[model samples]
Target: MRTPIKRDDLESARSDLLATAVGWFKREQDVVGIFLGGSVAAGSADAYSDIDLRIVVQPEHHLHYVERRREIPTQWPGFLFNEWLPNTQHCVSHFQPFGKIDIFYYDAAKLTPSPWYRLQIRILHDPRGIVTDLVKRSEELPFLVGESDVDLSISKGLAAAHETYRRAKRGELFYAQTLLDELRHHVMQADDWLHDRTPETTVMAKFDNRASGEVLSSLAMSYCPCLDEAILAALSSLARAYRNQVLALHEKFQLSRPLRNDVAALDMVA
Candidate 1:
């Protein structure tokens, strides 16, 4: 059965699932701490939001847990399956009756927090006060992007759009579309820095909630149907938007706009 995006029963079921998971983690001797992140931690969760559960393991047993990360999520009721985020210790656990959870494993001894905790984290279990203290320290750190990062983001975005243009001209729509999507992320990162917000670890998530309408609207104008001509036009539009953003970022951060020559070369495309 398809679950409604917003429903009271689904909310109740999710709360119950979270409560049950909390109980299980608290009883497990090796599990040191538990905290929520993502939309749940930000207090903006809707019925469809996944429970981002950070599971802190006993430092001595961290390796053992990491080896069998799949075993942990399988313990949840109604668990359909879990998929690991590539090259990371995080898993997205999907369930049948109601909801989903993102389980992130952390080593208790090696716990080092960052500014991410300031925006998205709610501690539920911290017996040793380790996670609590780290979170407090992280919250004090400023969440601003560096000039080099902005330069890299805009340069790469423009480069990707150029690649997309080349691929579209060659009739490789799929690959062109792929690069176009990558360019979108580059735009998002640039936008984050333009407004002095920290770029999210998970790209393309919560951007709608955080970004200004002007940024979004400009990007929206670049979207087009998946036809060769349409895609070529989209690449052009995206390139123009990036150019404008480069100038804006230049004024805001005194960025060097190192991609001016590359962008000029890209604009020579028909």
Candidate 2:
């Protein structure tokens, strides 16, 4: 039977692997830099988290460097290993030793100005200055500057809100389904941008911090506005709460920027 790897087991294995790697580095005097990235470095590691490792070498040694480290994983068995050369200067290695490992390679100078630059990183060994320089450079890297389009939301939202007013004007139920759908999309899009995840939690509930009131009000007013006063009051409360959330994210991340309606407004909200 293949033994199952638990979170504790992965942590222990990483500790052991790092120990072995550090000893090898000390012996291999030419090896200049080593660092850890990915989930462990971010303090969000779990059993499924992969080890992200990087090693920097001297420029002259780049030609034969892959040949040198290719055998490193043989030190530990039961690991499923795969490796790739991302560029002439870099190699990426994946090792699933009871868990997963993602490794990167680079020369000392190539460490900076790479798109893979991560904010949170841990240096295992830096006999030369490459690791420190990369860390310093990462802090100064630019943040996201979103693209802009149009804010058709004002007209769209008001139109939908007016429809709900009409429904309320009639004796029928005041449902805000259409407005709710649009509102949900924008709120969800903003969350996706913030979390950097494709799928996020639901937009409902008082605990959901990312909801938007303008979106919600437009949604609610588009819905069953002709419903009883209590129902309308509840929808109004939800819209207000969602609006507060939009404002908060707007202040913190500049998420309120206008954008092309070409992309779904929700997708562009962030």
Candidate 3:
């Protein structure tokens, strides 16, 4: 059985695990390169920050490595539990003495250039200098989503929010909240696009723009358990923010404005 971990011992535990990982990577022949990113590479890691690793392997050995990914934590010390994320390429492992590591395995030949590739990264092992070349190429490429995609996201969020309001009016509180969650997700994605940030698994608190962060915080706090109150609150917050985003898009590009029909459906006095 795995021993219980104390919160106070998490940092030291993670440090030891990282050292073990670096050593293992250096010795593994199939592993072509290893890069460290996320909060640690970004220099913003706190006691609560989890370790993130990008493992690049030989193209021919990609499937072999991925299939055996579960064995990774066992090779290290203090592994407690692990959860595979929806993406087969990613996994999160928890360790004894309290800590988590998020690992992403990639085929060196199949790796694509994106914002993540350019983020603060430390190449731990690159015998052929493949990662160095990729990093250099990533810097020359612009990481951006098209304006049309941003417009579509805003429209989807508004439509979902409207449906959520309708569901709440019909007394389907659970389903309404479910749709509200989707609306929130789309809104956050739109925010990411506005700032030229990758929308994937973005943490709102890490947003560089203070106004965007405040908007997200306000929308989160607007959620309520009461059905009618929640519906109105969610719709109001979404509509307000959606309008601002739409206006910003129009100002920057020639995008069409989002319709305000959803806000009109809400009964403000109720």
**Number of the top TM-score candidate:** 1
lDDT of 3 by residue, 3-88 (tens): 76565687787788898888887788989999898778777677788889889999998888787777787778888888985549
TM-scores, all candidates, are 0.87, 0.50, 0.79
Q: What is the lDDT of residue 237 in candidate 3?
A: 72
Candidate 2: minimum summed lDDT over ten consecutive residues — where? 198-207
lDDT for model 3: 0.73
lDDT of each prediction vs. the true structure? 0.77, 0.52, 0.73
The clash number for model 2 is 16
The TM-score that candidate 3 achieves is 0.79
Off-target runs (Cα >4 Å) in candidate 1 are 1-6, 198-206, 256-259
Residue-level lDDT of model 2, residues 1-270, one tens digit each, is 887657777778776666665576556656798887765776656665567777777777755666655556555544566565534433334444565555555766555563245446788888666778777666545544242311333334334434433443453343544444454455445444444332112212221344444544544453343355543453454345445444545555544553232223322221
Identify the runs in model 3 with alpha carbons over 4 angstroms from their true place.
1-8, 85-87, 192-205, 212-217, 256-270
Q: What are the per-residue Cα lDDT tens digits for candidate 1 across 148-251?
A: 87767766876787788889889999888889888888877777767766534342257886777877886787677888898888777777776676677777
Q: Score residue 49 of candidate 1 by CA lDDT.
A: 79
Better of 1 and 3 by TM-score: 1
Candidate 1 clashing pairs, residues 3+ apart or interchain: none
